[model samples]
Target: MGEATHGLIDGARHAFVSPGVHWLALLLLCSAYLQGAFDKLRDFGGAVAEMRRFGLAPAAPWAVAVIGLELAASGLILSGWHRWLGALMLAAFTVAANFMAGRFWTAPKAQRGPMTNTFFEHWGLAGGFMLVAWHDLGGHLGV
Candidate 1:
């Protein structure tokens, strides 16, 4: 590689392997859910409406459940208490929500690009959660 490219790669490697990087990464991963939880709490009515738009009936209850799960997952993962369980919860939630809300294949052609991007983005987040679970499990139960 060129000298500049090599330097950039080395810098990235350094950052990736830094001490406490795992903790930082986990925190960053949990940030989105944390923020969402706060937003739902702050604007509960809006959240319920959004859930209703997604065809989730009993919008109020579903909204509450979603916020509760987000909070629980954030707490567990951030506290490192049963982190694997938290990761799994978040991962499963992400997968389900992505498929439910991101239906790119069913969207109009003009909207497919953004919808597909969002769908894949959610999956990427799910993969991050899985990685967190695997790391936290430390090969326990074969992860």
Candidate 2:
């Protein structure tokens, strides 16, 4: 590569290896869960409605469970204590939720496309969590 291109690549490599990068990436991964938890807390009625729409019985209880899990798991991850366990918890949650909510095959034809995309995106998030778990187990948890 040209000298400037090589320097750019080197900088990026260094940047990615920094603790800041790890912290930022972990925050990004947990951002959705944190936001969801906050929003549910702010509008518990809406959360209950969402649970009901998803056919979960005792919608209020389900909403509370979801909020608690999201907050607890994401906190474990961000705090870097039992990070692997937190990561696995979120991974399992992501898979279960994808199955429960991303049933694209049953969706209307017009909506199936978006639903399918969401399904795969959730799977990707699960995979990211798995990788985070692996990284933590290896004792290289930068966070």
Candidate 3:
């Protein structure tokens, strides 16, 4: 092939290759998304109970609202629509999880442990999600 032809081919190859990285990143994000979604549905009652355990029973409706937000955020991520909004929702989830952890820390000892660990794990997942959102939106949308 001529020099110009080779250059065109190389550019095309790189263009195709770069999006593979983005898809892999999205896959990692989707995996985490699925896990978080499952946790919300699987332990619906326990999550509600944990709110009471953590003395947020007065805000039980708020707890349910958070679950709805999780589902909505996951849906947005899946649809690839309004992704920045999804990122904001995930960030909110992070804050809520951390707040839950703090509440558990001060609760009666017997109601701590496993729940605390789960909440902290959720917090970590949120951090990973922040990176994904940064990659998807911050890099792309500049917001």
Candidate 4:
């Protein structure tokens, strides 16, 4: 490759694999869920009602558990301690929650589009969590 091309590639590689970049990526990945957790905390009663709307019996307990998991995942990921475990936890939770709440296939025709979109969005977030876990486990893109 040309010298200029080689320099560009090296710079890109450094930028991509830097610790700052990793942290920023994790922050972006976790931002939505963190907001969700905060929202649940801010509106405990509303969260319980929403959980009941989702058909989770014992809605109050389920709301507490969900908020707890979200907070735990955020702490583990932000602290970079056992981040892989946190990522896995979030990924599993995302999948279960998506299926539980985003039942697009069974929804009425009018709601299918939005519900399906949400379901896929959650899956994408799950994939992002898995990628974060892989990186934490020492996988890299030749950086």
Candidate 5:
């Protein structure tokens, strides 16, 4: 390799290892993400029932599917298995969850009470996962 190319590679190696930032960031992200996944899993049945109660029975299957996807994605991310792909999937799910929460916030007052609280919690969890996805992507791209 040319001198400049060698230097560039060395710099990346240094960045990837010296500060230990990559692993630390991934650890934080994965930890937070896995926690959210577990939380959602614990309430998956409730989530489906809540959707049905809201007259979104047609979406119950979808809700279940999403929960499955989230669990799978969390597993992949935590294991660093095809990490880039996992991060992308997780990020997409995060965005979709945020959008889905908005619908709950606009429901009738009685329905909105619990949903409003859940929406905010989802919002925060999604934001944290997004950060994890971002950092994971950055590390994979060597940026």
Candidate 6:
């Protein structure tokens, strides 16, 4: 690449590596969990209904557990304290939730397409959480 091209690449890399940007990226990744937890807390009855819809027995307890996990895990992640643990918790949660909620394989043909997309999209997020955990565990490339 030309010098100017290299310079542009370097600049972009620097911007991406900034601490503030790193925090923002993590915040973006955990935003959904945070929002969901808060929403569940705000509407406890609705949360229990959701748990029942997902076929979780003793729906109220499941709802409470999910709300607690989401908040605690996301908090640990954002705070960068035991972040690896947080990432792993979120990763496992994502996969479990995906299976329970994103049953695209059994969907009607017309609904299959969108459901499949959402299902895979969530898998991708779970993978991202795994990567975050890996990096937090000192598996990152020299950055």
Give a tens-digit lDDT track for model 5, residues 1-143: 89999999999888877446755766665565566557767887776776665456576686677667766776776677766667667767766765755677568888977777776776666666666667666745554
State the lDDT at 44 in candidate 4: 99
Segments in model 2 whose C-alpha atoms lie over 4 Å from true places:
1-9, 139-143
Output the number of the TM-score-best candidate: 6
User: Could you tell me which 10 consecutive residues in candidate 5 have the lowest summed lDDT?
Assistant: 134-143
lDDT of 2 by residue, 93-113 (tens): 999999999999999999999
| Candidate 3: segments with Cα more than 4 A from true spot | 1-24, 30-33, 58-60, 102-143
Better model by TM-score, 2 or 3? 2
**What does the lDDT come to for candidate 5?**
0.68
For model 1, residues 46-127, the per-residue Cα lDDT tens digits are: 9999899999999999999999999999889988899999999999999999988999999999999999999999999999
Error (Å) of candidate 4 at residue 81 is 0.8
Better of 2 and 6 by lDDT: 2
Error of 6 at 96 (Å): 0.6
Number of clashing pairs per prediction, in order: 0, 0, 0, 0, 0, 0
Q: Sort all candidates by TM-score, best to worst.
A: 6, 4, 2, 1, 3, 5
Q: What is the alpha-carbon lDDT for the whole of candidate 3?
A: 0.70
In terms of lDDT, which candidate is stronger, 2 or 5? Answer: 2
